[model samples]
Each structure stands twice: as structure tokens, then as C-alpha cells.
Target: MRFIFSVLFFALMTFSLSAQGFNNGVSGEKTFTFFDKAGRNQATFFSTTPLEDINGTANGIDGTVSFDVTNIAKTIKGHVKVEVNSMQTGIDLRDSHLKSPNWLDAETHPEIRFELTGMKDVKSEADNKISGTATGNFTLHGVTKEISVPVTFIYLKESEDTKKRAPGDLLGVNSKFNVKLSDYGVQNDIIGNKVAENIEVTFNVVGTVK
Candidate 1:
């Protein structure tokens, strides 16, 4: 009877362990640094107006995220930032103009950042991903505004493929949101109808944790 009880307990433990997925049963708060393989992280912006539409990409993306694997919806926190001077609009002249004081003023405000505050309306998805609305403070051109963005996060356990990108477990974040240039003290009218007042921004970044 004693032997049978021990076998039953062992089986239960194995079952519990197998039930854990992406995070590999890791719990509590884990910090994922975006600095590793940051070049692959991408951020883009699109502006549309009646006269013309323009789009640009910024390659300078890095940040850190701290969150509990067990309670991501409630405990996720971090900040993602993009270098203002790294923006490229295909046209070299326009790119230079964008970094000038009349534009983003990259010399003074080198980075545009989003600091996560809280999350809500979370839903679990397949492949160890979660979708939710994240409320955060977005700072651009030295001005900060409160905004809510729909974000999706995916966790990948360390493996051979993941090691190719980084050294540890990976956290993937994807989000797209709209921002009004005027809200951030950006003058959208200087370019005439070429630049829209509202711009759509999208980013996909992966951070890693050991």
C-alpha cells in the first residue's frame, strides 16, 4: 500500500509538470531585456492625408519588460523606446527635415518612449500568447500623453532556434496604435497636406530573459 501511494503521487507531479507550456512552469516576475538582437526589432509609422501619404521606419528599438508569467495581465510592466534620429522616410532630404527642430527635434528629444502602466481586457490565445489593452504613458518630442494600445505578447521557451536570436527565453510583443502629432506638440501643418495630423504606429520587439 505504501508503494502504491508513492507511485500515485509521482504520477500526479509529472502530470502537473507536463501541463505547463511556454514559460516552462516558470513563475513570478521575470525581466526580459530588449537589447539582445535589438536590430531585428522594428518600429514603423504611417501618415495619411488627402494630398499624400508617407511612411517611415525606425530601427533603434530597445527596452526591458518585467512581468509575472503566471499573472501577466496584472503584473506586466516596462518601457519601450525608439531613437528619434533613426527614423527613415525613404527620402534623404525628408528624413533630415524630420529630425530638425521644427519636426521631432531629435537632438533634444532623442528617444520616444512608452511606459506601461496597466492592462485590461486580457484574453489568452494559442501558441502561448495573450491579447489585451495596455494603458501607458507615451512620450514623444518631449511631450507625454496617456494612451491605450492593443497589445499582444507571446512567450517562447529557450530552445535551439531561440538561442540563434538570443541566449534565453523570449518574450515577443506586437502593438499598433494611433497618435495625434498635435498631442505631442508636433506641428503637422508645416508640411502642408503631405503629413497627416494623426499617425499610425506599429512595433514588434522581442526581449529575452534567462
Candidate 2:
């Protein structure tokens, strides 16, 4: 009886700490921000350039991301997977155009992936916005590129949509990363694609706690 009580106590304590630093072991949806060419109109350009995918949480960043401060490193690494077909722009035509051979070519390679390399928490020089520089290898269109994106991570608690109830829940880190289409060899391949040379990709991801 005493041993069982001790086990319960330890479990409760671990959960409490996990809840406090949800960003550490918790996973959240990833949001991406694709940019447009320097010369383009954005008024009719609704954010249809949207995709739906989530990472495996801190594991998306690294296998061992402890909440403790001293153990923290200059960077955390993780893997992210995105379903290229789940993109929605509120406009079927635009979405289809994007998914067609002109842009994403989703039929051939239906997923976009990234592996986190390093993170630099700093304030941006352009807007003074506090951001972290997460450098990683992004594989798109069956091509991989090493890119650095500035992300602002805000950690939050689990949603009510959980099918299984747990004593504690996951951690959600809401973040956005932007990129240009031309940089990744998408523009030339896209036929008559009025799609801007700059394409913004975002992630709304959720990661399960370990």
C-alpha cells in the first residue's frame, strides 16, 4: 500500500512540473508564413496559402528537451511532418492551382518536412519583435534546403478536443516560419503559375507529451 502511494505521489509531482513548462516536453501545432514577391498585390491575396500539419511536440524540436534551466542548450532539435494536400485557402481554385503541378505538385510528393538544427532567441532588427532563429533542413518538392526562420513561440495548454482524458495534457507551441517559392525551385516548374515567386507556409501543429 505504501509503495503504491509513493508511486502516485511521484507521478503527480512529475505531471505538475510538466504542466508548468509545457513547451519543454509538450508539442504544439506549427504555423508557417509564406511571403510574396516584393512587387505584388495582397488585397485579393487572402491567406489561402495555408496548410494543416502538426509536429510530434518537443520531439519535433529534440528528443531530450528538459524543462530545467541549467540543462538548456543554445538550440533544440526536432522533426516536423506536414501533409501537403491538407492546404486550404478558402478558395478551391487557388487551392487546386497550388496543389497542381504548377506549384506544390502534391501528387508526387505529398508531404513537407523539416528538421530543427539550432535556435537563437533574439530581437529582430527590422521590427524589434522578439524571435528565435530556428535553423533546419526543409525538404519540399523532394528537395531539401538549409534555412533559418525566425519563430515566436508561445506555449499553451492542451485543447478540450482530446479523445482520451489524462491527468495532464500536452504542450502547444504556436509558431510561424516563412519562405519564398523561387528559392526552392517551384516557380520555374509551375506552368503559367501566377503564383507569386514568394510563397508563405505556416504550421498549426500539436505535439503529444512524453
Candidate 3:
């Protein structure tokens, strides 16, 4: 009985401390708008296979986030989108091929998007930051799949230094996740040799409170 009570007490303490660094006594829902500030917001995709490694970056990343610092795990929601045609693989010909009908069909699908529905396993880190798994519906090539992305969020209060970048408070977000091409109905010759079946994606962006 004593052991069980001790375990329960530890769990409760952990849950209480999870929000330690996230709150600055300000508690409310803040709507944040994400914008492209000279390509400050970006998403990159990488694929590696035995034959070759391919990587690409998309500079056209924009989105909005509705977040509440006090109730982060329950009240965080947002959507991020990357323009399909903006993806560049460093090679013009390969970039063209990647957007062609046989590949991503950029004409039919003009954007890749992720809609954040909720968060899980949230824990506060140092420097007013928090880490968690962001649960969202990821849309790619006209297909939508539920994916969980491990993400870190840093909240910065408004200040003179931040005004140089934008207005209001700033939120920095960094996320990394892997997706299977076949799961999204992307099947091609490049999957086996030139590109890996699974592609790794990284997203980094900052948002200004609205």
C-alpha cells in the first residue's frame, strides 16, 4: 500500500511540474499568425536510399496557431501549409520531375498542409519552452493522414528586440517527423533506389501574436 501511494504521489507531482516553465502568470488564448520573413519560416524534406539521397526545401510556409499557455495540452490548435510548387530540390530538372503528374502532381495538389488537433505528452523545458507530440491531420498530394509530430515550442514575450521581427509576442516552433510515401499513395521508381520509402521532414517557423 505504501509503495502504491508513493508512486501515485510522484505521478501527480510530475504532472504539476510539467507546466512550470510555460507560464509567466499570463494565461489566455493567443492567436498567432505565421508569416514568411525573408524565408525565416521553412520546411525541408529529406530522403535517403542506397543509391542516392534527395533533399528539398519549401520557403512558402504560412499558418495560424491558437494557443493557450496555461492550458497548452488541451487548447492548442493550428494549421500549417507549404506551397507545393515552392519546393526546390537544388536541381531544376529533378524539381520539375518531383512536381510532375507521376510524382506529387503539384498541379492537382497546390499545397501540403497539417492541421493541429491536439497535443500529448507535454512537458515544460528550460527558457520558457515546452515539448510534446503534436497530433494533426497531414495532407499531401490530395491525401490526408493522421500523424503525430514531435515538436518544441518556445514562447517569447513582446520586447524591443522582437519588434524588429514583428509585433506582439513571438512563438518559435520546431518539429520533425517521418512519413511513408506509400501511405500517402506516392509510389514510383524513385522510392526504392533514388529515394527512400520513408521521407524525413523538418519544419521551423516563428509566429507573431495577433
Candidate of highest TM-score: 3
- What digit string (tens of lDDT, one per residue) describes model 2 on residues 62-181? 222212211112325566655567665555675677678767788997877777766654432221122456678888887899988766444333456532422133323345555666
Each candidate's TM vs. the true structure?
0.84, 0.54, 0.87
Residue-by-residue lDDT tens digits, candidate 1, 101-206: 9889999999999999888777667547777899999999999988899998888888999998888889888999898898989887535455787899998888
Model 1 misplacement above 4 A: 1-24, 49-51, 190-193
RMSD of each: 5.9, 13.4, 3.9
User: What is the lDDT for 177 in model 3?
Assistant: 88
Candidate lDDT scores, in order, read: 0.82, 0.47, 0.85
1-210: candidate 3 lDDT, tens digit per residue: 999999999999756755633766556788888876787788999987677678889989889998777778888889999998999989898888888887899999989999999999888886478898999999998899998989998899989999899888899999988989888887655523457778899988898898
Better of 1 and 2 by TM-score: 1
Question: Distance from true position, residue 50, model 1, in Å?
Answer: 4.2
Comparing 1 and 3 on TM-score, the stronger one: 3
lDDT of 2 at 52: 27
